[model samples]
Target: MSEQVPQLQQDPQQILEHVFGYSAFRGPQQAVIDTLVSGRDALVLMPTGGGKSLCYQIPALARPGCGVVISPLIALMQDQVEALQAAGVRAAFLNSSLPFNEVQDIETALLHGELDLLYLAPERLLQPRTLELLTRIELSLFAIDEAHCVSQWGHDFRADYLHLNCLHEQFPRVPRIALTATADQRTRGEIAQRLDLEQAEHFVSSFDRPNIQYRIAQKNNPRRQLLQFLRDEQQDNAGIVYCLSRAKVENTAEWLCQQGFNALPYHAGLPAQMRAEHQRRFLREDGVIVVATIAFGMGIDKPDVRFVAHLDLPKSVEAYYQETGRAGRDGEASTALLLYGLEDVVKLGQMAAMSEGSEEHKRQERNRLNAMLGLCEITSCRRQALLRYFAEEQLEPCGNCDTCLEPPQTWDGTQAATKLLSCVYRTGQRFGASHVIDVLRGSENEKVLKFNHHQVSTYGIGRELSANEWKGVVRQLVVRGYLEVEGEFQGLRLTEACRPLLRGEESIELRKLPPKARGERGESRRDSVAADIDPADEPLWQALRGCRKQLADDNGVPPYVIFHDATLRGMVQAKPQTPDQLLAVSGVGDSKLERFGEAFLTVLRESQAAPVEE
Candidate 1:
């Protein structure tokens, strides 16, 4: 006996304030909403925490029918639905996790117009039965989340996303909005083409995440370095540590646990149930860390993640940006720390070269890897380079990254470059960096002596620099396109770009090897969100957090689903004592004010009543 929900046809601004408790629209959200409400299509490229959801959610509630959303991840859909439901909006999701009866109930509700928003995965929405059902109900719009998946060049591509253009073909009149947090110019074009969004208006927001401090250091005992970072700065805060392999994920998680930190492992190889449970714990609990590969972070909705660390190099700038973008999602000051070495570059290069794909695909991948390496090696601002890669211009240097805080010294390396190139050529260019370094350093190792490289003209010519210094030169050369990694064993080969440097026609300036580890040096620059709180207000903050945890547990939702950390911080700072006062908080809507307003007010009142120790 379900009843059809009435569509209010309310103004978008009213919907934003009354339902979601936001005062106004952020960036291009209002324009995107207007486009959809006017029955037009939009392609939006906003950052992860840039209020992308409001672009469609407000329009859906204002329009006359349920908004059908195509999402890529089951967990993401569940989180969004829960958050919307908390705001008193009728929302539901269809995924394999639901039982048969629940699915039937949700489908029945959809038919009766009991839901304002409906979320479905691409595979399910493409089914004939689902398509048939959609035709029977009025759909306000079609929202495609993570729309970059439609591009084969995208980092998180899904084959099913390629068929999503059918939405345009099947429902020509339904206004559609495709949204993504990470997409290069090339990927954006592909997304528009594959999703049939060529005619859609494009909204590209600034890609900068200023609250995150970008720091990439040379790998010097990476495990110990990670431990130092956590213990020194983010000891009790929730964060994610990304590793490059499944074994590394498991090992890092287990090691963190042994070191007395709450940690979990997540990867495709883990059992589905375990992965789900781990993800659940990460979202619902506090101070929990998940060490995982790239498989784990596509659709995570947690907002208070304090930091994201990379123990190995990412393959491309897009992957690095998307992965690190997971942190400080609440717009708090957070850290993005990366530890890399010459070996990481070689390993990633080998992977790109050996991967199965078209030659063009392989070349693009190599170019992407080079870009990523350049990002790590650059002497200027990291944020500027990152934004530039996405075709966004940043004229001024960002004072937040490692280089800006402590600029690296540079030296004339023309002589060093010539010596290294000659060594590679003398040794036949068939050996890897290590053997080549040994030959240059006159090691007389078994391999070097056996190859008769000890008698070469360039033998021991690079003795002016240490082995590590020589590695820096080689790494920079490879990143600069003067050297290329090739063959099954990843031997270094000289490209035509190296001829000028070797022939003395061109001189090069290279970054001097840091006398100390960059990680230890950059420790003082790390900013934690907790630092924002006044020392005297610590007790009140704890009480508020405890209240949030209890309410979240009782309601069986993540703490953030009830109220984000920013909202809680607002409550603490304002100490609202009445319903009207509580409603002034940014995230407090009419629905939330009615449901949890009094409980929070009571907490605020009790805090006021406590006497000062002084």
Candidate 2:
């Protein structure tokens, strides 16, 4: 039997004071930290602001020696290293971005035991020479950031991650921790299996970011709609605008910049140096709008982004959430604007159908995309619908979204739903939403004329609603359980839930599409950086972040390893006076309390005295 590890008996607050100079832990950080510090493996799924990094960073520092962090993106490694250096920790990275001398210098530091933490790409870690070198060092632990990449089903799969099982084979004694912001059930299982973490403890945070208001607009006059969104709701805050094509990325950025906002374009096609320069400028300069494909946002560490606007529909809600999560990482209020058309949905559906995954994966992707479409088209609380997609039950509506702001007028759609369903069944359910809508509206359009749908009994009965209104009704019907997408036919079909409506056994209430004028209740807020954040408080956040950075640097861990924003927020809020008091905060274990705890306590005391003057 495995020995039961003796529990460390230090106060969390004191550990926080000594190691991270914090007085508290936020959300599940303490629980997660405890699991890791106990020398066990853990798989963490937390939101962007949920402080996932601290779960491993602090524990790495509390442990005996250097920790290795396997990160996918070289740019991400550099950003992490810089942040750690700012906090006064010994940190270095090995990636292709570095020159030979720099890489050798970092390796020498690792060999000489001069570094506490080292960030490496999976490819580098798997290198024979690198593995040979690591055999000489006394490693403390291993951490994998963005663990979802290990699964091919994931949005950002990296083939190199599949080789990480070598870490367990070579360093059997070292503990392992894998962290990611997003993963569905299947992806989670795949991660555990692929990374050889089957026995690891699992920590899943609620996948809801309530502070972000969700909105989806029909793709009509998209540029105009985006401009209106910027003018009405954005409040001149900086945001990322995602496009599907590089050409669109360039055009949109240039147009926005011409309109007097500081906008820039970034895409894979651009020169690497130019992309890096622009990204740095956006990070350092506030209120700069970035228009790019998905290339610009991932691995971006900017914290004060107020919004994430997409001019095109993302492939899935997972992509949407991960992209949007970039906004408001500072834990402030933000918005997620999605503009898509029928064409966009069709295109995505085709792509999903074409993917070389399992039938179940394709079905799930379609369902997720449909859910996203429902979120966009609904005249209800976007936040409520989004939470529901994650299987969360929310009765009370969020008052911030467009629907909640302008309440939708619902009517009894029992008769209308019956008519729509009947038409689908009679027509063999072989067509998509548009054809169904056309059939109902009695349009003499080409498809309708060809199908001779103007002669059907149900034809012309829906003239009371416009084509757009009919589209909304059909979409809403599908969401409300009266209909389902027929996978084989690639069309809409009635579900068992529709039986009651058709048989007059039940009544369905349908909300009328709000007037275009009504939907225009709020103008885009300014498209500039946020003004409400106290620039003065930034220094304190930076100082606390600095302490976090140093701890991570010294331990060769991610900054979040030291303490999460919530814990740091607690310290900034409570500034404890002693190590014993620090131990009271969450995320500080006895081992952490005994190791390097005094150093953090000193920083906290010193920080409190100077108070990080702005």
Instruction: For residues 150-191, write the lDDT of model 2, one tens digit per residue.
Output: 988767889999999898898887789999987877788999
lDDT of 2: 0.75
Candidate 1, after superposition: displacement of residue 545 in Å?
A: 0.3
| Candidate No. with top TM-score | 1
Clashes per candidate, residues 3 or more apart or on different chains: 0, 44
**Span of 10 residues, lowest total lDDT, candidate 2:** 1-10
Off by over 4 Å in 2: 1-21, 374-407, 414-463, 477-508, 518-614
Poorly placed runs, candidate 1 (over 4 Å): 1-8, 518-527
Query: Candidate 2's error at 310, in angstroms?
Result: 2.5
lDDT of 2 at 553: 64
**How many angstroms is residue 590 displaced in model 2 relative to the true structure, after the best TM-score fit?**
22
